[model samples]
Target: MITIYDWFGYELPIKERYQLIKKVGFDGVLLWWSEGFGRNYYRDAPQIVREAGLFIENIHTPVQNQNHLWLDNLDGESLTDCYLQCVADCAEFEIPTMVVHLPSEDNPYNTLGLNRIKRIAEKAEQLGINVAFENLRNLANLAYVLKQVDSLRIGFCYDCGHHYHYYPDDDLLSMYGSRLMALHLHDIGGSYSQHQLPFDGPINWAAAMKKIAEKNYSGATAIEAMNWDYKHLSAEKFLQEAFERAKRLEALRLYNP
Candidate 1:
């Protein structure tokens, strides 16, 4: 069965986040750095996720850490060292993939991010973790990053919404199915909004997912949504709806297995 890790940022407390995630009906929770999952978060979250019959494990950057990991002209050895540390920490349990983002598109020439990713991939190989590269706002930018980091451990986290933002059509996604490690499933207009739902927005995700399955893209299909109207729908309630949403998507026959 497919699962969604209710994207709970640093806005709410851990206990509150866990409670809501369970109420929402998801069997997984993707925690970010900003969500206060440092030493304390790491220690406490595992138990809670297990208690709820959910898996607790995910990678996210801190607010100070920049959601966009700007891996440009930095000491390669040191950056790699730090990434190795993070991977080891996640290896404690309930972790299988490290979701990451790219740097600025203006200077696409920089290989810093690629080098760091390679280092992390190497480290992950030892820790038994996968490094999932997210498709940024620009496809060209992501393509360049992809061109640089050519490793089996370092794979793509296709953002269906981004494809729609640039342009719609299954053809756009067909080109990268071979590299899919995970998917940041969301919807976009014919423009740039990182997060939205397929039914709520304009991106043709049903088509994109079709290619993902056909290609046998064996990886996590994570719903990387950021927006939340916790007013009418609390995190607990929302999480439940999210699972149903995934069920509907599956019934759509996007993924063959």
Candidate 2:
């Protein structure tokens, strides 16, 4: 079954987070595909998800940073060692992939960053783990980084909300469709707060989900909404929205052609 995954950062407790995911009918989650202000959720996460029979498809972790320590930095060969260790941990728990951010101009156009990521992919490959690269910040423009790396193990995590955030002109869905292995499905404001619900924002769900279906993507689509915690809403209310949107996508898939 094609399942929906969610990103529940440190906002909710780990035990409650798993129960909430099961309650919402999501088979799995993206595991912090977004930023974590503090603490590594993965440090003690897998056992919880497993008890609920929920799987974690991917865990997004920091690779490159500015003014902060970076994993794929140009100055050191050891940057990737840390990243590889994270990957190793993911593999041990049967997490499928580790979503990484591309190093930016902070490290120059040097292939060192790319090489480190490549080596990370190599480590993942040895362990049968997948490596996903996501669009972040201005570089959230992810196509070029994907193209530059051009490795199968290194694929794209299509963050729908991130794309809608700063670049409405770009068709990331088509640009990286073939390489898309995961998605961060959340709505963003046209002129207000991002990560709002589907109907709460100006995003065109029909068009967006249709594009995803067109690609025949076989990956997790996590509902990355904030401020609308699953525990607060009644099941009828939650599924009412989820089922309706899913049905809309189903309709578009068959009728549009």
Candidate 3:
């Protein structure tokens, strides 16, 4: 079945957040590993999510400001170590996927960086976790790294808003297709990542959903949209509308198999 998941940021308390997500009709919640590690909030998150009766869709890893993981000449080793620990936590929580990112800017790939990815992929395979590389501004470089690694444990996480803003001309859904292990679904305005609800902005929601269905993507469609400018509506009202919108989008996966 196609799963509808929402992202869990450090917005509300863990219990409240997971409760709200469950009430909002999400099948699961995607945890942000960065916030958990940053605030040293590793222990309670999983228990709260489980008690709230929500499945952990995936855990998102950290992103760097400059010289991202797929690049070299920086302190990426520390980041890798953090991610490894995060993967171990995911294993303990029984989470199947972990979303990661490459660099956000144009940069040359480093051999050391590629080796680092390979090692991570190998570890994930051993631990039975899938590592999903998120699409950012540096699609070409990311493509190069994916080609080099070519590991089944390492797949793609297509972020709709990022693709619409950064690689506007590229048909990522078609390019990555079945290799997609996860999705960060959000809408965007012109040249900016609004992270708005699906169809609330300029993205062609129908066409994108059609592509996903055609590709037979069966992973969770996690909503990564945040409260950017929906302040006019009350939080409860906004969440209700978001759930309805997500349901409408979920309908596109009806025939997907």
Candidate 4:
């Protein structure tokens, strides 16, 4: 199925946004499971999107203080609790997967972080949900976590923009493609990690899709594009473009060559 991030740079009401997403021909949406967007609104987002005739592909947990999962402090403990709660929330909402961002930059991997991730994975396994750890700047930390936590419920969420911008030489899909559970497809140009639509930047779409296809990933072809650069376009127009790109991505995945 084709999906896009829910908060794709629109200021409209959540219902309207969801309706527009459905109207533009997307099959599902990836929601941010955080009160940062507003407590009640986000809490009700699953029903809202479902009522609008869209599927909840997954929920991305808040990334704030994610680094605390590594530190041996009260804050780290708090963050672990927060992630466990997020896993429970996925169970409550019936979301099959939860995309997570590990520590930012080059944060060191430690037993503290490994134990917290193990706890979260245990919760996920018990609750029948998948936790997908996204790739960031440091590959070693991610490698360590994935290696140490061998839960079948623990998987990887591949972000195209992040891999291109942060670790271009590393073939992340090859390393963790066997455990791939979700995707954050976007593009980057110039310097920073710009979450632009596919083909809007320098990323090699054919190559990326080829790698994913090699893994036999049959999950939603999801885009996490933001609207920062396309502020001039109307929401409908932006989403229409996104839908087209999503279809293109699917076609690429299906192509043998």
- Strongest candidate by lDDT: 4
Q: Is candidate 2 or candidate 4 better by lDDT?
A: 4
Candidate 4 lDDT, tens digit per residue, 1-257? Answer: 89999988878977799999999999999998887756457888999999999999999988877778899889989888988998899999899999888987668888878888988998999999999999978678889888999899999999999899889998999999999999999999733457999999999999999999999999999998988888889999999999999999999998859
Alpha-carbon runs more than 4 Å astray in model 1: 8-13, 34-43, 62-82, 111-113, 166-172, 189-194, 227-230, 254-257
Consecutive 10-residue window with the lowest summed lDDT within model 3 = 1-10
Give the C-alpha miss distance for residue 34 in model 2, angstroms.
11
Tens digits of per-residue lDDT, candidate 1, 1-257, equal 45555543335775677666666555566656333445346556667667767675466433233323444434435445555666776787547776766543553544555556667777878778777666655456567666776767766777776666654643545666677767667655422355554456765546656777787765545665544433356555555555666666665545344
lDDT (CA) per prediction: 0.60, 0.64, 0.74, 0.90
- For model 2, the superposed segments whose C-alpha errors exceed 4 Å read 1-12, 33-36, 63-79, 104-108, 190-192, 228-257
TM-score of 1: 0.77
Candidate 1 global lDDT? 0.60
User: Candidate 3 — which residues are off by over 4 angstroms?
Assistant: 1-11, 36-39, 70-74, 190-192, 255-257
Best by TM-score: 4
Per candidate, the number of residue pairs that clash is: 4, 2, 0, 0
Q: Candidate 2 residues 52-107, lDDT tens each?
A: 77888788775444212233445455546667887887778788888766554343
Ten consecutive residues with minimal summed lDDT in candidate 4? Answer: 189-198
lDDT score for candidate 3 against the true structure: 0.74
| Best of the two (3, 4) by lDDT | 4
